[model samples]
Target chain A: MVTETQQRLDETHAAAAPVIEVRELVKVYKGGTRAVDGVSFTVAEGEFFGFLGPNGAGKTTTIRILATLLRPTSGSAKVSGIDVLAHPGEVRREVGFAMQTVAVDPLATGRENLELIGRLRRVPASELQGRIDELLVLMKLTESQKKVVGTYSGGMKRRLDLATALLHRPKVLFLDEPTEGLDPQSRNALWEELESVNRSGTTMFLTTHYMEEADRLCKRIAIVDEGKIVVEGTPAELKRTVGNDVVELQLEADSPNELERQRSGIGRMLEGFEPVAEIKSSPAGVQLYVSDAAAAIPELVRRLDGDGIRIGALTMHQPSLDDVFMRYTGKTIREEQANVHFTGWY
Target chain B: MIGVAYETFLLGRRAFLRWARVPGNWISTLFFPLIQLVLFSQLFKDIIQLPGFKESSYLAYLAPGQIVFAVFLGVSWVGINLLMDYHNGYLDKLRVTPINRISILFGEMVPLFVTCAMMAAVILVTSLALGASLVTGIPGALGILALSGLFGIAWAGTSFVPALITKNEQAAGSLSLLFFPLAFMSTAFVPVERMPGWLQVVNNWNPISYVIEAQRALMSTGFDAGLIGKALLAMAILFIVTQAATIWAFRRLTA
Candidate 1:
């Protein structure tokens, strides 16, 4: 429940200092596959930033480089003001990474998995138990903490993996598709958890192919494709670039010619209206692209009244992030399957 | 250096727990060695009376070989554990930690010492339970476990090198089988005199034979310092060579 003023203050604070900065980072694999090509961005402290893209669009590769898991072929990245190449160990200490694949040990119990990572991250022995207990409860996994992770459900494994990453309370968290394969319910639950984590002042850098995830979680997002960021802005700002809210009118027409006549009649009536940007015909009735559909709906109804064009249903909706993606990339994202690439030392 | 040791201890404990929690790991490792120890001892009971046999029974001579065999079996697929981590992105998880990278490798290696020794102990206890004598008794049994543990640590490089080089689970697994001839050609199944002329010549240089001979002395012939020294030297040489190659492979994979 962030108030408008509080969010504005937080944004102001974030803009005052940058926690992560990348300058033309590039990663070219052995066979000349340029995974990340000249990507550059800076994340303000406390900002929730995301790279929204289809898979193989370099989101994972860029996040991996920032997390100090992979080396770049050219350019530079810094986390918490530490150069990733020059001082990766220092960068590692300040950040936590939850990979796309769940990395928990199936044989180890949930508690053991957290304990191992906590110890490796140098969480003090005195505080480790308390932290694990807190996280287990937070993740709603207290009852199953002693059970081996192999017995946990997929959502439970994901929660446990996230718990391990949060163990050390890193300053910056890098999540690569944190909820990629989750059911809708689990995905929503994890989204709430992530929002709470970001609200606690941890700078978040996330990469995902889910448009809804980016719209819901990221304060700012970069739409990436073909190893380049095609567009970057807040979700609302990006969506606004796609132009105008849509108001579709379902009409009561007995014949196709009557429907066409009614459609042209509505179009001719709304043509001179200041708020309506454009009017187009549809199979059922007419569609209006309006600057503010809610404000323009009354005027629209008045114009259509007594024209023998009866309206059965009216629906108004804002342009969605997918529309924004399609506006830039010229293809819908829903049909694209994730192209998962293994950049291991093969 | 101290940081590496600490990290290794912590991660090694996890690796050991991962092995111990799974019943299949120990069951599979001990199955072949136990079958050979029980069946072969009875099947070739009269082979001991041929010419060069000194033990009172074939089981006595067969116990030490089974102990070494258990060590071999315990380490054969140890590298696949690391490869699993690599495939599952657990390796990347560990890499992002602030600890030294070598700790990950050492962590996997250190636990083999305990598991190999424990597996060897099971065979030793079973052999004694079946009426095989331990001349030097409990102290001898402890010595045998120590040797097995050390030998297990040294021999694990065979599995690790292929795993890291190929980065393929099947290749790593099959390549470990290529070392089975080393185990079979050693003195595990026969004394040097009972072997063919060419095999006996091969036995003189076989590191597994040195370890088996030392364990055999502890089991029946009493403590032989010369035999123990030769076994230690052999393990040291093998450890240096295999581990060198293993380190190189690990570096290349991780680099």
Candidate 2:
């Protein structure tokens, strides 16, 4: 039955139209900056689309535009086939947005807030109560439903926000860094909840700066940077674009810059890989993005040892989305976020 | 529209229920209006000369005026409530819901304006107990109610333009910038007739003044229909203007 359900869903998605579609989306704020500079992507009917980027990478801007909160300066987007600009109300009806912070009213009880949203969405009165009860249980807030939201823990508030967004049973759910600023435990729990939500056939369009989050949740991702989509594909496919594995060499050197220069020279010989994006010194050590770590390691070591930069530490791991991100942007996501804060909007 | 009204009614019930958790807030919603009625009626009695003047009768005439003032103050004071919604993301729940978005404002208005009107009536009845006569009858009484509500529409509308524009609670309360002066410029403490030539000209043109005068005329016997019509018309125009400004602000806010 599980297989049957999965097969039916796959076939249904194959037959059904895209839930979200954006074409040449451009958003220029009141200032002169272009946040989403002619970026575009499509989200299939039931796909969990991760819009991954560093902080300044226009992820939130795109999400806000898609959520119908902000209008694009040019270009267009449609949620569930409804043009966001032309029919924002209709788009709003089809999508549920849980913004970075769960903005639940502290004065009201969790249950009251849910009921209020239910009424706003015009949920049938009889069905509304049952749905609220179901969401309470789903979010594990049944025990605290009657308590004022102000008294809720950060995780609890976030859960309620998610519940409120889901109250109307929207076709597309947009979560903007849903677990951002959350503790590791809370984030993992929320991730599990989101996975279950996906299992229930909700098309989630999630924007996240956390690479692990994108890797864990998104079937495919668009790695956006500097207001443009640098790459788009499944996580595995994008990682293949980098290399099968990433190797980092912690070399004992008097100077970091000298070590960086040494790594670059050793990096040039391993041009056997079709796409050797770049070799950059990662925060941890001198890192190389290569096609095959096993194939390149011995040759890389001989070449580096020939240069007299003794390796203090050597570790090899499968390329993560972070490495894939570094390949495209010449920097890791966290480095980009630290180096710049995004002041523009999509 | 009926759905909107009903939903607001439901929300009002919920918000009012919050008093059970924090019962102290009810004191101001009920008692604050009465205090203004008593304080202003006594303090400004001789200074504010109505069309029909009496030292004792001043309190009676000032009840409806204060009622209108109460609604203005209440709605504007609750600007922080909307800010709290913004901060907590509670408003987003309403934003994403399939229902009419106007219900968000309507729900606020239901308890706020309706309660202001009810409190205004209680003040009016209390003034009667203290020897204030009904210079006008049931129509006039109902007119007072209408005046308080319309003033509320304007106040609620005016407050919304700035409420959501603010980022957090402190900025939201900065709404008092618009509120305090708008209250004072109208007929809350003094009859529009009592203001100096320049200020009188300003007051005559003020939308809030029209609401006060129209409401005052409805509650007093010596009232003229033409002034009442003009006052009501001014309020109607201001109502449309305020609502448009609010919706535009909302549009900007979402943007």
Candidate 3:
């Protein structure tokens, strides 16, 4: 009783099969800090997967585990189906990682850096120079190819580092905040480069706290907090899960009296509305997670007018990645970034 | 392993390119030793008088010692670069590359070895300008330089232990005090025979003395196979300690 629907389902499942699978991964530092605790996810083949987490949320620990740099305290991971623990060397061969840190030799030129990586990857001697040339151009490092890395700007060094990782052309590439501190131009260029890389048939696993970048680049994302996958799905899927719309009302003033009054005033307005799934307020503003933002906004404004409570302004928009993170983790990405991250470490 | 070796060579090229891009670094590496030689030779010649039998040999003794000092000072700077790479996000990049992780450590060592060799050559040249020829013939003299390069390797190798202890450059540089005393306690400046009994015993065990004595043996008497053997053996022992220390440090931290 074979059916066409069943065949289609099988083909879809095959398309979504993960190239990277990490299950129950745990990493406990010496001081009893469980950096990565029981996190699990699968990065599907050809998917641009994002690991979105704040600093100290275990993104680096998880990345380190997959890269075979730091062994997990428990659990197992497979990269390109190779067991990370049992076959680190094999795992290394199939995965290219551009770590958060820059490790390029300052004494060497960009060309030399690429050539060295080419040779290390055992690219045939005849093909080495061509690979170097291609990577140099791709990174926009051709102008500085013969110049030492010490003289290169931060963006240039980062591009060169990325170029070295790309030189080997592995099945999957791990980029940890690939454009964290770059200028807007450089960051956009790197994003464009990554798009082309994905188009070339290599899966990219990225970790970043930049919500917009994740929304722009990743087909799927795992929002991580406290060393766990709080939720995972496409940027659109996760945003959709936050219901349909976000309702915001700015507080007219910074006074405590105004803040408390505004909080309870908005609270009363949406109390009995079922489609208004959630009402959350903070110092900056009040937000309503609603099923239909446009329909509720006129009604909401009427209540404020009837009560004689001032509405600074009200606007409704689709749920953003930040709202999704807040819905799942009870804190915004900026809060998490501020807590453990160096203000300039990006 | 061959792949690892090639990566190390390639990475060394990168480090070299960094220096070439900044020509000031090359000038400093070439000239730093000569400045130290002239400064220290004049300072010691005036200040602390050691019982070295004759003032005539003071400059001779200072010459070999400066070469050792210059090599160590120049080579140990490699650790700072390694630590900088870590801080600047470069070391982390290398960690995940398909290139052997050992290449990261070995790559640092190669440029270090080259830098030490060059500084030694500079000091040797300056010694020649001061009318100092190895009382040992030219062939014997080159051997001295070769052995001194090993001392530099051992010194630079030993630095990895501190690197593993702390990723902070300031902390690593501060800890270099331990290595400085080992050089001073050696007979690099004066023969152990002139020391008091207890100090002489300590001097005998100091590894740098073996290196200095090995060079002194060659400079004082050319092509003595037995002395060269003992010196080489001693240098080998220190080299082993350093190499082992570096490998163990890297394995312990990285694993």
Candidate 4:
């Protein structure tokens, strides 16, 4: 007797049911440092979820808890509906993890590494050889399959690391900064490969501080800071919250007194504009958040000239994931990365 | 149980393969004990002339002790690769797998057992070639190797402690210093009766003294059930305690 709309809603909910859930998870290390504090989130089935954070922002700690590598101080987590704490072995069977650190044996050959992992994961003997060959070919590692890992380049090692995680065909794959140190070309190649992996219907939970990685790959991202999630939404939705575009204006004055006066002078001129949402002035320049930067900049230039303020340069920027991060976290990702004081060992 | 056993075998094979790949490690593990055996035999040949020295040749007397020494040295290096695995994050990779955690411990032990057994055979053969003979022949030599392998297992358990706690290669390597004092204080170089009064008491208290005496008995005399049984009991206690501590430390490190 359900209506058509209600039936559609039920179907949508069933298809996107949570595969990973964290409830008030906290991890306090020895001596009183809290690495993860009261964090909670859910990653739905087949969702490409990204956890974006700077170093020491508790991203690794949260990932470790879910991977069953470390026990949480309190609260609960479930992976694929199995309690991470109570049934860790069952969860391990369903989840594959590639840590920030590459985990292959340097002296072992590429094929040896994959075969060892396959045996450890208990892939059937009949299928293990074919699976190993398939992964080697898929990763383009077949040519170097017999070479020692120590001789392999960084990018090659990373590919083998991914190959190991992909063995046994895990339902959920957890990758922690998989492309942190790769070159642009290698990063792009890995991105394409990961996209194909996601296309095959496996849920992916990736953690990275790279803005473009999250923006391009993840369907939804959670920006975490100081052990807490600052914002969570799709890239477009989060950028929409910031505004349509940003106008960066560089204006110079003859003296410090004139510069101070010119700053307030521009603020006043832009204040009455209907498209302008907010205006912030800094020593470097003035930034205006607006609905349409193209239409507002022409009007802004006319008013500046009428007010006798000199305009040095002007540029318009579309709202990006970086802008969304700055709007919520009050600092750029690079600045936050520099300011981080790492306290606990992972 | 069979799955765990099979996994342990595979893990063991992997460890041996790692050893095979490194030629420098190959030469050191193979020749280091032989070099030590030859040097100690020549240097301490006069020890047999001392009072209370019952054995005919110092090399003969020192051979069993050297076999035990080879086992100790080989087993101590077991944690070196484990610490390497820790530094490079392989341990975390293994933790997330469905493989039995005990295999991680047992797997490393396999290579150590092979190394110890190899060294045991080499030192025994070297001793025999250098005019040291076994009273009970090949069977007695095999018994000495088997018993020393058991002690190697016990010592290997103790070696894992430093590796798990420190997770540093140098710190784990320093733990080998523990065997130095045990080696010098026990009845390894000279018979306990010839040792100083205070040292004789210390040697009596040292577990290595029982292991040496048991191996010496099997090597010089025929089978002595009492001596071997006593050594077995002492090793059994050490194995139980050290292995328990290792398991606890491993759980804590991962936890």
Top DockQ prediction, candidate number: 4
Would you list the C-alpha lDDT of every candidate in the order shown?
0.90, 0.76, 0.76, 0.84
Segments in model 3 whose C-alpha atoms lie over 4 Å from true places: A1-17, A253-258, A272-277, A290-296, A306-310, A341-346, B12-57, B110-113
Interface RMSD of structure candidate 2 (Å): 2.2
**lDDT per residue as tens, model 4, B1-255:** 887788888888998888777776646755766776788888877878889777888887888887887777777767777778877789889989988888887888766666667668878888889998789887888888888778888888767888888877787788767667887687778887877898988877687888889889877877899989989998898889888988887777665
Q: Tens digits of per-residue lDDT for model 2 on A126-217?
A: 89999999999999999999998889999999999899889888888999999988999999999999998888899999999999999999
In model 4, the Cα lDDT at residue B252 comes to: 72
If both were scored by lDDT, which would come out higher, candidate 2 or candidate 4? 4
Tens-place lDDT per residue, model 4, A194-305, is: 8888998889999999999999999999999888899999988998898679887777777878877788888887767788888776445676788877877778787777
Which 10-residue window in model 1 chain B sums to the lowest lDDT?
A: B246-255
Question: What CAPRI-style quality would you assign to candidate 2?
Answer: medium
Stretches off by above 4 angstroms in model 2 are A1-16, A74-78, A81-90, A250-278, A289-315, A339-346, B1-52, B55-65, B77-93, B102-111, B125-143, B162-203, B206-231, B252-255
**Per-residue lDDT of A1-346 in model 1, one digit per residue for the tens?**
5698899998896556589989998889889998888888889989999998887788888998898878899998888878999999999899989889999999988998999999999999999999999989889999999998999999999999999999999899999999988999999999999998899899999999898999999999999887888899999999888689878799999999888888888877777798888666655777667897788789878988988888999998888886677667765566554466777632
Q: Listing every candidate in turn, what is its Cα RMSD in Å to the true structure after a full C-alpha superposition?
A: 6.9, 6.3, 4.5, 3.9
Best to worst by lDDT, what's the order? 1, 4, 3, 2
Off by over 4 Å in 1: A1-17, A246-316
Span of 10 residues, lowest total lDDT, candidate 3 chain B: B46-55
Output the lDDT of residue A12, model 1.
Answer: 91
Lowest lDDT sum, 10 consecutive residues, model 3 chain A, at A337-346
Residue A10 of candidate 1: its Cα lDDT? 82
